[model samples]
Target chain A: MRSVSQKATPDASRRSETARRAILTAALDLVGRVGYAKLTIEGIATAAGVGKQTIYRWWPSKGSILFDAFLSLTTDQQDGALPDTGDLAADLKLVLRATVDELQDPGFDLPMRALHTEIVHDPVLAADYATRLDEPMRELKRDRLRAAQRAGQMSEDVDLDVAVDLLFGPILNRWVQRTGPLTHEYVDLVVDTALRGLKP
Target chain B: MRSVSQKATPDASRRSETARRAILTAALDLVGRVGYAKLTIEGIATAAGVGKQTIYRWWPSKGSILFDAFLSLTTDQQDGALPDTGDLAADLKLVLRATVDELQDPGFDLPMRALHTEIVHDPVLAADYATRLDEPMRELKRDRLRAAQRAGQMSEDVDLDVAVDLLFGPILNRWVQRTGPLTHEYVDLVVDTALRGLKP
Candidate 1:
């Protein structure tokens, strides 16, 4: 069993990439319009103008496809890479403000919410999402906090794991609950408050 | 158009209260068994040994009934009131630990997740849940923060609303995302870290 990368020629690889992008776009659009409960693999295949077998060849299930689609949508953005401005407060504020913008964007909001709702309802999906998406994003934030600690901006004793949660959790809570507007001011406050605690 | 309170004699009021508790119990049980998407008022009424109109008389919709059922499940516990031990750190740690316990309880977990899923998918329900449940919970935490500020344990300049989010948001995020264990040590770290930021 040869790997796809090993077996494919350059032209074949390019075409597969195009097909992948189209499939993801269709999946996101359908999930946004019909929601997670209503979305189906056949619907995504029809929307993408791909055969059902093509989707199955690439993805094991609709959930995995939707998860990959979410990752694709987010990867082009900051995708959890924090700015290393050497000013901890300024860097956090910049990253979090961008997050507020992403959370509020109409294109990202509904599909993301649909995915989150499915995760909440299904334990297997929830664990898979945690491993595939949540953990990677958290590790990126943790790396930044570790850098701050090395710079002597943050205390050496501050737990990077807990600190990452402190930094991103409020922003996520607001997004999930839709408790209030996800504004720049709100992110600024979250950064300021959490950083003050982490500062040496 | 008489209110239930106005129409009820003492015996009738006691019987009505019993019926109300039964309905809520049935709603929670059914939601836990079949999930929110499959749960219905008719199923709950049958399970609770009441007529369908009995449920309709009290709740405007299944979502409203589920919301109330969640409130009933939680109200007997902390109910958002932080322990005012006068030591801000101790008070916060105690409150958050209780929250971790609540989040992990199998009895409360599935039904609460179901209600949360509904809120995520429906804008009107999301607003109602925020106003009726999330806001009140935040306010209770805010009031505790205010008291800490007046006592000089926390800075007067700390934005109470933002502070409240910073305090509770990490725990809620963990609960929603299932990112990691909601351990006592985790809550202790969260309380200590956020309090460090808030301290004058």
Candidate 2:
């Protein structure tokens, strides 16, 4: 029950952040090497050289620990913003190209994939991941497309929800299913096809 | 080395088929329960009520067993197919509506999700899965769209790949990510949006 007010005592605050970071790093490392099921709080604590209570005080479960770890790894654990450089197509292309880069990074593959697999199997983890990770990305994508629409780039009647999916879904399908090589060319293909209406 | 000879009796052929079905079923049940990593050849043997020698004499690894299981599951799995009753939008709607039904079916979810997530991390498994499952579904969708294209119902310039993704991507995005409710209404939204192409 010790909230931020109690933690704001400088000594507590400093120790908490340090332990939190250590715990996250350990969790990420463990999942990367051994996968999600094997990565436990005790294992993470031993690997992090922190007490198990330290991790439990912050996170309730191993899945929770992983949720934080993925968040921090992706964007410093904040509600990260997507790029908004003013051109709808350019901005979309840029964001997707960066996403392709992230997916391709060797350091990210294992743990991210582990998290993905876990989400598929465990409903609790899937719900938590969706609420915390997936929805934000979706909203971010939607907001960007809405911005484009307001700027007169997209059609007024464009279904924002499906449009967001059209932009990002193929990339996701590729990543989750490993259906194809996720090259820059592939990302461009998605962006181009999504935009300009994919019709003659 | 055990290629069936013309002189070989029907009994041997029936036995081989029976073994094949047992291995496939065992793989599905085991992978569904324990996961891909822990699913060993010995484990499959025990689960299938066969000897380890019987398994090794046939398939090579757990991956191949699961691969065969998934193939059979997909082929006999369910009836979520694109309807070709001649109306493109209606056909698409019917197909997607069935997919929504499948995603909602508790029996269909866990195993399919299990295999999907497992393959995300396993390259060999992923490649085999893509070949067996993802590729075929994609091609089916593409062929449907192509037929629509020829019938003057769809845009010829629309990349069938992109169009298919647009058609099914949101539904899948919801299913895989668990972002939102995947209802008949949601399917209708995507079907309408994708067909319209957002051009004023």
Candidate 3:
């Protein structure tokens, strides 16, 4: 989608882009410091050195701003594919281990966890989250699994949705619920254990 | 733990128990009606026909009240064991399907989801959640899996924790994220796939 500023003068468009970036950056920084419950639009505006009206014109609420801020970071970091080294287990472990590291990073963890907390309570935000972030990422996972199925590394009869959930669900559940430690060894075991059933 | 009321007269103890029940009931009812965000001590007191001091004397916060209320409901419903029909897959499917239904039930859903939303943000509450609710439930699940191991229905080498997560995680992830329909069929497939593996 083209920006509304596309029809505006070059100088005006550049300024708009600058303000947008600043607001997103400020939202992430402030959320990390103050926590999501205490984060306010006035605080973000003051931190960003922009008018509160500027933020209001673009995003309706702090939740929306945080969504965009976290989404921007994710989009910047991802190259749009789960790594595929032709070994399905190795590829999954590689990606999931990276995820563990990212979630552990203080900079990323607070904002992402904040976004998840918001997603749990708000249905509209959850829909936006599913459409924009989750589905695309899930598709990338499915692509890798599809490749594995074709390579005869996985059963062709396996349902990709269920398989995808099986592959990623334990790690995700732990993160969301804080049920267990997120670790490289944990991801490796999760991958190995999922690929090989409990049945003897 | 014995109630403090155990030291009091039987009439006084009975009165205290009645008030305690009222507060828990009111907490769940109010949360379901107005949501956790808007639930307040004043509101709960009015609904329960008790003074605000009554609620304060017992539970320190709304979160605690909701926790007790939810815990009571769960304990009453559970029989202290996952069914051991001596069929691992069928037993797991039976319990998980019941879980799926409980999550879908209107009376149970709102307060439970409210507790989860709080747990996501509050480390203290998360700890309480893990110790008081999750660990005991997980022990029951592990017991069933251990029975499976002994029966030769499962591999003895499998990590019980990881095995437990594998069987329950997909359904839980789906429910928490609203990522898919929570159907008995979905739970059945998750059990089968996790037990059978994707390896052909």
Candidate 4:
């Protein structure tokens, strides 16, 4: 709790904000270590060096804590925001390149993969995973594809939804299956090759 | 072990075949009930009415036993066949549709999902899973894509490797991520859209 006297000073509020960040970081580190099934409020509090009551006061569940912790780490505050450089191909390439880097990180991949495994059987987790992660993932691609279309780089009838799904579907699939080397070259090739129809 | 005399007889071999099927079926059922981590050779032997030594003699590891059991269930024992309809689209569609059916089945999905999750972190398991499963998978897609190219359905300069990857990447992505509803309609859309370039 912020001291009433400290709250009166802007500097103490900033210090409190730093404490909140440390707590979130600690929660994320703990989730990465123990995984979803074992992640508990007390464990998070201990990791965060905050009271269990503090976490409960802010969030309802362990899943929420981990999800929010992860969300903050990505630094992507808005789901719909993608770069609008007016060059659609370059923009898509830029976003995908960032995704490639994000996916390659152990911090993001390990916990996300753990979360994904549970989501397979748990509908509540599945719905949240879809809404919070999967759909936003789709929207990321959809926005890029829409941008491409608006720039006249992609066909008008390409069906932005389907286009996004198809484009992302393969990339997502490759990542999930670990089927191939997911490098910048691979993403660029898939994007380019898909643009040029298979039939000449 | 087969006796020298019984080994010479077709009927005795038939009986051995029957027991092997029984063991494999039991293995599948048991693995479904208790996950791979909990599954045991003794349990498989008991369920199949075979001696523990019989399973041990036949399979060196539980992973091998479960692997064989799963392979038996998913495979139809076709004679090294890749679909060869003269029409490339039809041929590829037929193959993909069959895969869609296989992937959609709970019998296949459960154990496959379980094994898939396990292999994500274990490099040895990942290699084993890839060799045992992905080789045939790669072969099936490669053959189909090549057939299309040879038939002039695909671009002449189309990179066979990339095309093959594209054909199944989206489906595999959906399957692993549980991101989207994978259906024949979706498959058709993927195949069609992928075949025709996205450009206007």
Off by over 4 Å in 1: A1-8, B1-8
Candidate 3 TM-score over all chains jointly:
0.85
What is the C-alpha lDDT profile of model 2 across B96-152, one tens digit per residue? 887888778755665677677777788887888878677887887887787787787
Scored by TM-score, the top model is: 1
Q: Assess the local accuracy of residue B85 in candidate 2 as a C-alpha lDDT between 0 and 100.
A: 73
Report how far residue A150 has shifted in candidate 1, in Å.
1.2
Pitting candidate 2 against candidate 4, the one with the higher DockQ is 2
What tens-digit string does per-residue lDDT give for candidate 3 at B141-176?
A: 999888888888888778788888888888878877
Give per-residue CA lDDT, model 2, range A1-200, as digits (tens): 56866767898778888888988888887898898878888999999999988877788899888887887877752246777787777778888887878888766777888787777777788899988877777787888777777777788777777788778877887788777788887777678767776222
The residue ranges of model 4 lying beyond 4 angstroms of the native Cα positions read: A1-16, A77-80, A198-200, B1-9, B77-79, B198-200
Every model's DockQ, to 2 decimals? 0.76, 0.49, 0.46, 0.48
What value does the lDDT take at residue B133 in candidate 3? 78
- Please give me the total number of clashing residue pairs in predicted model 2: 0
**In candidate 4 chain A, what residue range of length 10 has the lowest lDDT sum?**
A191-200
Q: Candidate 4: what is its chain A TM-score?
A: 0.83
Worst 10 residues of 2 chain A by lDDT: A74-83
Cα displacement (angstroms), candidate 1, residue B148, comes to 0.8
Rank candidates, TM-score, best first. Answer: 1, 4, 3, 2
Weakest lDDT window of 10 consecutive positions for candidate 3 chain B = B1-10
How far out, in Å, is residue B146 in model 3?
A: 0.6
Rank all candidate structures by their DockQ, best first, as comma-separated numbers.
Answer: 1, 2, 4, 3
lDDT for A124 in candidate 2 is: 82
Pairs in clash, predicted candidate 1:
none
Give the distance in Å from residue A175's predicted Cα in candidate 3 to where it truly belongs. 1.5
Reference contacts reproduced by model 3: 0.54
Q: Candidate 2, residue B14: CA error in Å?
A: 6.1
